[model samples]
Target: MRHARPLPTYLVQRYHGWKATAYHENKAWYRRLAKEGQHPRAMVISCCDSRVHVTSIFGADQGEFFIHRNIANLVPPHKPDGDLHGTSAALEYAVNVLKVAHIVVMGHSNCGGVKGCYDMCSGHAPELEEQASYVGRWMDLLRPGYERTAEIADPAERTRAMERQAVLVSLENLMTFPFVREAVEGEVMTLHGLWNDIGEGDLECYDPAKGDFVRV
Candidate 1:
């Protein structure tokens, strides 16, 4: 069976997504919804991967969960975004404007973005041409975790360790935003850290019980 050149998964998913929209009477739905208003209950910080879809995984509909997606599903501390911060902007909207009740930072297994972090840590990206201006420097944020786990000799175990640390770091970054801090302090919002193991088709929630992620 021949497939399209390069087989871009997003292209296929987009075609099917459009076809599935036949049942959606989307004629001016956004305009009508604008009149109705929106108040989503959850805000999901997720990866920009074609396979990791929070809406589908959570079985949510439009206006159900507001979403923010970026490379690695990362949350950087609230710095004056002199650059476009799609995730931070969306987070501000959800936590401040929409006042969502829950914020879920979802990291996933076998993530290429997380792999990039690993590759960088391995000292494999020595060429300056490999990064955009200051991106290489900013990527240093991940160094602490990688160095702490350097004693773990097994490659697979090291990767998993790094990925989990990324989730925890991102969860902590959420608190850097004042709105998020206020919401949590006022009991208006709760934070959750989740890991989606694509290989096992399982969702793991961070459990304080064992101080690690547990299937939920």
Candidate 2:
């Protein structure tokens, strides 16, 4: 702990600025939130891309959303084995403890994780195939999505399709959890899939009936 670096000056300055402005303006609200534990109505599983501003995009206030970000917004099939399952743990707490009414898996355009899966599956990235590669192992979840979009000839289109596939895959995997399935079956909770076009600032939501993403 002694070797830990001090906070960067610019970040420290920004924090102070936020404290003076936003925090000062909403002191009562912030205090109320601190006194009362969070009771978020939704849980959002999104990519760890800095460009994907989950709260900003949804115009959410603090403590309104319970968010979990991973490589490609993936949710692995429910496995009860004793392992360090970070995403699964978050999901369990969100569904059972928080009792969130909705779980949203939001993928985004040009995700590095999705692209890496494409490269590895296409035989372009051999390094990722190694057993010790943490990223490679994590991205293995996206392999099925790549396979589903393999028939597309255009590289860009294929990647785009795969991005949407990631959302679909997570939605399907969420149901694999017994708690999630029970909540959904009893109409206590719902699942949603979303894709964000970062460049265009466009949002798309999955339409289960049409089996495609529709512009939002």
Give candidate 2's whole-model lDDT. Answer: 0.93
C-alpha lDDT of residue 70 in model 2: 95
Give me the runs in candidate 1 sitting further than 4 Å from their true place: 1-32, 81-84, 127-138
The clash count for each model shown is 0, 0
Model 2, runs deviating above 4 Å: 82-84
**Per-residue lDDT over 4-45 for candidate 2, one digit per residue giving the tens place of the 0 to 100 score:** 998999999999999999999999999999999899999999
Candidate 1 residues 1-216, lDDT tens each?
Answer: 475477589998887787678435574766666888988999888888889989888888778888888777778778875454666789888987898999998988987766667777787656422656354444455566678789999877887877777778888888888889998999989999999998788999998678899998
lDDT, each prediction:
0.79, 0.93
TM-score of each: 0.81, 0.97
